[model samples]
Target: MNEAVDEAGWDVEPGDEIEPLVQAVGKLLKVCREAAGLRVAELGEVLGYGEDMIRKMERGARIPRPEYLDRADQVLNAQGHLRAFMKDVERARYPRKVRELAELEGRAVEMLLYSHHNIHGLLQTPEYARALFEMHQPAYAPSEVERGVVARAARKSVFEREPAPTLSFVQEQVTLERPHGGKMVLRRQLEYLLEVGQLRNVVLQVMPTDREEHAGVQGLIEVLKFADGTAIGRSDGAFNGRPVSSPRDLRILELRYGMIRAQALTPRESLAFIERQLGEL
Candidate 1:
């Protein structure tokens, strides 16, 4: 067991506190496997994972992906117990801040965004996200970069929710041109933007660099409106740069976002512009 633990990368002391939810999931996996009379190695073979990985997952030293829970539920005949824990497992994979943001995003009924720099997180490709995290000022470790990439990709789940949220984005032309992760990465990103733009619930516009009068010159702005009539906003132009939820502040941000959307190229035109960029690439 000690050798297996070391192989699974459990660098912490034995008494370290594991996340409660993760521990709960591990217990559930163990109970189900035992109840089904399946040994760890047998279950690992059934799931196409190594015995050490299964043991680590059972010990709460590692988090399993959602699909893993589904398969475990089937193989262990735990009915829906394992599958029911998928949401908790998924949440445990992300950092605290990302989990909070994703919660807010999940509850949002609508999102309005103006990006003067990089593409919005929800719109970024995995390669693009990995590259961006790798280029962080202090430089992220490989594991940190992978985690960031997964977290960002997880935010796209909003697009898959029932009665999908209304999303509107205005991206600066210069942002599309700047190869943050080099030309090929940018090309795939632009292509992805075009794909996401075509979704019925999404409105994507491009703020042309040639425009002299830009409403969003102040900087990136994001407004998320919830189903309960409350909203939250953040912007580079805001005095303290903190997220604001006051109705007055939300209204002010909405007004600016509205103007930016109006001034930018229409969705159809934006798609054409992106296509042109792809051709140039």
Candidate 2:
């Protein structure tokens, strides 16, 4: 393996659900390399990967990046066979919980989000998200942080769905002032928020720190309602923090979120507030 590969922050989570799929793909990769009469080192040289990475990927011990599959298809003449796994591998690269949340977001026609200390994942810019992940308590490895950034970014597709969903966001005022990724990153994030806030189906609000009675004092809250009349919700201070789908449980979350919205600045005022913040930067 190349020196960089040895140090690269890529590792497959033990007992992950993606283990079987990765292993299967890896075995095929090995077969393809052998069929093409390429030694592991030779393959590594062409693919710009270290032998260790190549071997790990081939053993299904690592999730291959899409670029790896694409390049491998061309190098080994697999005729797109290897490329077919890109989507699966991409999904495998993230934790299953992130993917599950993304799936729920995709199916929802209405989403209500509240943030306590940071921007919601769907609203965060890639750079901002990267900075946030880089600040994790244990300090995520470069590869792990990259995975988080990609996963967060993928959730943004909700904004462009053919039938646009109603997206209501309430952010704590401190989230706007805190420079999570330095001043430049915060500036860009505010700019992006302004752009998104202007979308027809979006309602963005800010909850001020001075508010005497805050509904969101409980913490972050999220509720997504689908076209089929089914809805799911989760809150930091409710139900032991697990997601709830029953009408009764959802009612509790909705009640809290409704109050949060009522307590926040109106959408128009919020945009003006963001613009003012940006000007100060």
Candidate 3:
């Protein structure tokens, strides 16, 4: 395999302060291209991307699309490097908490999600995502909002993957009823939810506002189960509201989600519930 080194060369020196994830795939791509004795223009010719795109890929300025990555992997004869790199890039696209969640998501055979304050990130449409970002308490610059919007939008692709993981989501009734980004945007968001809920891999449940003892009262929790039967759970704690994740913590959260699912309407009934909520709009 062709190898390259950091600025310090192959010498064992100080670690990379920039974080290996920053330019990891980029460096790998550069090395892979060089090893194949292919120029940027030559590689671009095969991928139908511009040399500039290839340059950005090597510079870490852009993350390659899965299709592009797959094709490049085949063309470069790099085994599965490009495909693996895409998964890494997808994880790196989000905040540390989000990245951790995404890593867990990829390994997960099933996910249990609860959202009370807003739509679950994975379920949000672009317009809805934009609205949520724009409504940030401290406010975000347009560029920052765009970045967040894209990151959240990209997470939706998990559902499209082969052997997709099972997703079970419960949202508070009020969240669905509250309109964000006006009527048209809310309508589109609801429509997207309805359409996505029909997927065989997805199960959406709605928790009624009048539920006597809502399990989600503890807060939003996401529990992910792996094929090995190992599970991780995350929740927002007090203080800074930083996320908490651990197998033990997840067990507690999983029980709570189980209760919430029991309390809420069934998936079929929830679909009807969402339809009724949408009709109110």
Cα deviation in Å at residue 12, candidate 1? 11
- Quantify all predictions' global Cα lDDT against the true fold: 0.85, 0.90, 0.75
Model 3 off-target regions past 4 Å?
1-94, 237-248
Misplaced by over 4 Å in model 1 are: 1-18, 27-84
TM-score of each: 0.78, 0.95, 0.68
Candidate 3: RMSD over Cα atoms? 7.9
lDDT of 2 by residue, 112-169 (tens): 9999899988999999999999999998878778788998998898998989999999
RMSD of each: 4.6, 1.7, 7.9
Task: List clash counts for every candidate, in order.
Answer: 0, 1, 0
- State the RMSD for candidate 1: 4.6
Q: For residues 43-158, could you state the per-residue lDDT of candidate 3 as single tens digits? A: 87766667766786687655555556677789999899878866655445455555555566777889889999999999999999999999998998665586678678767777
**Descending-lDDT candidate ranking:** 2, 1, 3
Tens-digit per-residue lDDT, 1-281, candidate 1: 33322222222224433366677888899999999999998987777778878877887877777778898899999999999988876677777778879999999999998888888899999989988898998987666677789899999999999989999999999889989889999999998998899999999999999888888978989999999889899999985778999988888899999999988999999999999999999
Instruction: Quote the lDDT for 23 in model 3.
Output: 63
